[model samples]
Target chain A: MSRATILSAILSNQPQTTQLPEDLQFDCPAKAAVTEKFIQMINLIGGRVVEIQRIEDINLYATAHYGAGERLITPIEELDFYTQFAGDEDPHQFENIAFAVFKTHFAVAENGAVWITEDRMGARVLPFICQHLGMLVFEDSIVSNMHEAYQLIGSQDYGFGTFIAGPSKTADIEQSLVLGAHGARSIIIFLLKKEL
Target chain B: MSSIKHPELSDIFNKDEERVNWHDDTLWWIRAKRDKAAHGISEWELLRETASQIKNNVLSNLHNYLIEFEEKAQKNGIKVHWAANAEEHNKIVLSLLQGKGINQMVKSKSMLTEECHLNEYLESNGIDVIDSDLGERIVQLAKEPPSHIVLPCIHKKKEEIGQLFHEHLGTEAGISDPQVLTETARIHLRKTFLTRRSALTGVNFAVAETGEFVVCTNEGNADMGAHLADIHIACMGIEKLIPKKKHLSVFLRLLTRSATGQPITTYSSHFKKPRKGQEMHIVLVDNGRSVQLGREDFRNSLKCIRCGACMNTCPVYRRSGGHSYHNAIAGPIGAILAPNLDMKEYADLPFASTLCGSCTNVCPVKIDIHDQLYKWRQVIVKEGYTSSAKTVAMKVMDFTLSSPTRFKLAGKIGRWTLKHAPFTVNNRLNLWFKNREMPEAPEESFSEWYKRNNSI
Candidate 1:
């Protein structure tokens, strides 16, 4: 009844149908330096980028920066040092995970964000609840802007997806930037060097 | 009982002159950041224009789009609920929680819930709702409402927040660093996110084409709460809808750049359907929005994305503080939107601005905010909601300005009072004389000078 009443009220009140605008692609501001701009933005937003030639390098990077006692989990099979994700645990079970390395569908250059879905995340909370996060982004997969990112993701179905640009942060206290507020404190982008 | 209006409330906020200056400078710093971020994109202006047109079209055919969104979202296995008003919205949420036998809940930053007074309502109803956003949690601990939409406790100093954390969150005293405060909150709320069965988040933009809604946040608290909860409740005003998913390209580019000068929020999470065995409920809340849609002059206010750019760019909001507006939203956008809900209660809000058009300039969707503000003044006055003194003042001005002889006489009297009886015009009763010095009274009127010069 509420739905019917609300719709009737809206129908009686809303203006006549107006046409949607034609889609137009805007040029990227940083035209040729997509990778450079990606790194710059990633650093500016308090995220780190570590260039790697192969997926095996992530294990070395992880082992050097992290220790064996910590729970370093990943969905990427190439990273042998990190434990493989089971993908079917209670979201609460992953709360103690110190590090999570997952693969992103692609990366957006302008904003330095990686597009990921629940499938890549292993669990919905894996990307958010971990103390530190590492998202693997292929160099060629870096699109210039949001338009390209959306074009790539046109009608692709996923239950949950996100564009993670940086680590969790807030500026609530007098505009001072504070990191690790109820989510991942640090996000390191593993930029894979591949042509395609 | 009648509450304090905008002028008096702002006067209270302005009493601490140093704090007022700090607030002004802080918000201006954010506005500057926004300018820098907007300048980074070559297509920034074009992007804003495209986003505005999309919103215009969405407003024009909102009913159909809402239906489309609901149908698609339901097909995606999300339960859709409709509420005609705030009370109904709250009730639906309560019933959902009750149905699950969940006593504790977690909510992210939702101004709609703030407008509905959901926290207190739920508290009295025995449902403990914890706000998981860092800023929101700070204000929640202080027993205060959020000051700004995006930055909830911008009015609070670090020392004050540290004190609040000390008292409520069991932090060490005098811990004023933002890093420590934020970490303490993360530890405190991590348990809440893990334990709470119901999670409610604000909807940033809901795509009718894909039946998925986006929640943008820098802290990622919304995802933490929703991903872990059994029942994910998203509260959305009907105006948050866009026609298609691709339109997000234009808006996502503009949203955070306008708010805090970021390329985008750290996490722009899209929730389309619930995870296996989890319940997802989207409440399409009217809550005076349909009435706002019918108002031609004020309908564009509904197009706001709650980025708080207008607030950051608002001179009145910066100097007077966001709490002064006494609405769920504060600042220029709030001034125009509040009166539509209760004109009599918010009659003074439209008059809070200087009609500087700065809010309109920075608005990502170009809502004609200053113009709508000016229009609301006329509507409020016509509805007899303005103060009686202002009404009388308008009547006298009308009588004097409508005729030449009367205008001339009134000018003569005004000049005489200013020149001879200066106290009559330079006192507390005249609001114009408060922060400004009245100009020196001339010996003769401009018309008098012209008549004598006669050479023209």
Candidate 2:
């Protein structure tokens, strides 16, 4: 088979193996300012950030903005929805989703991306198929950069995962900015405030 | 310059002065955005170094990593296929689709598939494949190859794309707004995604430590296509593998920043195990990578992450346009890589660069792109792959420069001819005069001026 031939050829020609670089060390300051950076970056990438105190505030924001009959879906039990997703269902049935919200494990400050896995998303397609997407992250669950984000995700097991940064966007046509491409037309980050 | 019918393809692209200038300015703006993004990260240079070292380790132990990757991916219930070349890769995809009795598929942006010409191959085999990326879809509608890797239809103007969408997707005439055009595509491709039974995507990184593969996209097209389809096929080159999943931190931070200057693409989804009742297949394609690996001097090119930074920052590429390179991937990186695939056909590519070193400076993994471009030139000339006219010109340049008397006399004659008979050097035979007018003969030779000034 071609596999053996290709492997042997690579072994013959490849340079002697070199060691991977040591674990990266960040000497930069601003590690404590991750929350500020996350808010700034998310806004820059066209995602709106709403600071709220209670879990119920998400519904307040959604109800104020969305019409009554819109198909708004969320995993948050406090919020109203037509049905609960059992995490195992046909993805095709989720089409025409006006808005979908889910809780994230943590968020990255450097890129405004929130880490969400299949457990949080009933289906892998829910985050991307909706017209609008809302990701709720705990105020304290923010990391400075990807290095720390990976450290938090160390040795974790999941079927699927992603870091959703911004709403789907494209500059393909003449470098023109279009907010919604195929994914969510808009992304709103509902940053929950800590209660005393 | 390589063909009898077309004078250098770049020259043809240059005929439209307005388009050429617009293309140059647009890419340079993207390069500026890259600079700003890279500066935001304090550890930018260190990250580049770390990525480079990791890739060096990957290349040296690629054979081991490939097998480890195969074992893990198969254990995850993902079928792994090995393709020796482009033909076999295409055949594997066709059989997979045919076995399922599916005739249509949706694909995301995978430069590997572009390198393999998968769409054309699939179409020939009676399968319909729609490219879901907006830029790719535009060029696909035009039935033309993508000019830029990251921005497939960068060479096109808004009016032209509006025209394509109007003809193909039934948009109203004279709709030149990019927003309108993009929304039209979103609605059209959404249907294709919902209805298609098969989806094929290109792998960005295949982790050896785990069975997972990551597909990054800004449009979320890959997720839409793969998640909805019954059968999912992901193709990757042998060189796309890394030893562990942790290394992704270094690459993910560098990838989008260097490309389009976004902190990260909108979606960086990791696919490990297939969903229940769904099929996931990965084709580990060699397709001349082994040969490129055996080439000791050029093997480092296999570490490319397919980011378009080099093209955006390349001076020659920006002005001359991507079609000038005449390959699936265009830009400085492609120049070095194209020659590895076919020395005879791509010998002209290495000569396309100005050796500006801008491409190397912006390269995320710190590929010595200019040096590789220079090295490929030497190999091409030594292998006798250069054009006969160029060979003779180089020989003449050598013969004249080696002797001072001949050099001085030749300089005198060149000045005399330029001053007395401009037509001789201003004709089509003069390649330099093709794209630009010959500079007026210098008032006097530098040496002559030096000699006169030295006496004072």
The residue ranges of model 2 lying beyond 4 angstroms of the native Cα positions read A27-32, B1-7, B434-456
Deviation in Å, model 1, residue B154 alpha carbon: 1.0
What are the per-residue Cα lDDT tens digits for candidate 2 across A63-165?
Answer: 8888988888877787766357776688898898899889899999989999999888878889999999999988788888888888888878887899999
- Residue B262 lDDT in candidate 1: 91
Residue B24 miss distance in model 1 (angstroms): 0.8
Tens digits of per-residue lDDT, candidate 1, B45-139, equal: 88888899999999899888999999999999999999999999999999999999999999999999999999999999999999998889989
Cα lDDT, model 2, residue B224:
96
lDDT of 1 by residue, A46-145 (tens): 9999999998999888889887798888878777845555655778888889999999999988898999998888889889999999999988788888
Query: Which TM-score values does chain B get in all models?
Result: 0.98, 0.96
> Each candidate: what lDDT?
0.91, 0.90
lDDT of 1 at B346: 88
Residue B90 miss distance in model 1 (angstroms)? 0.3
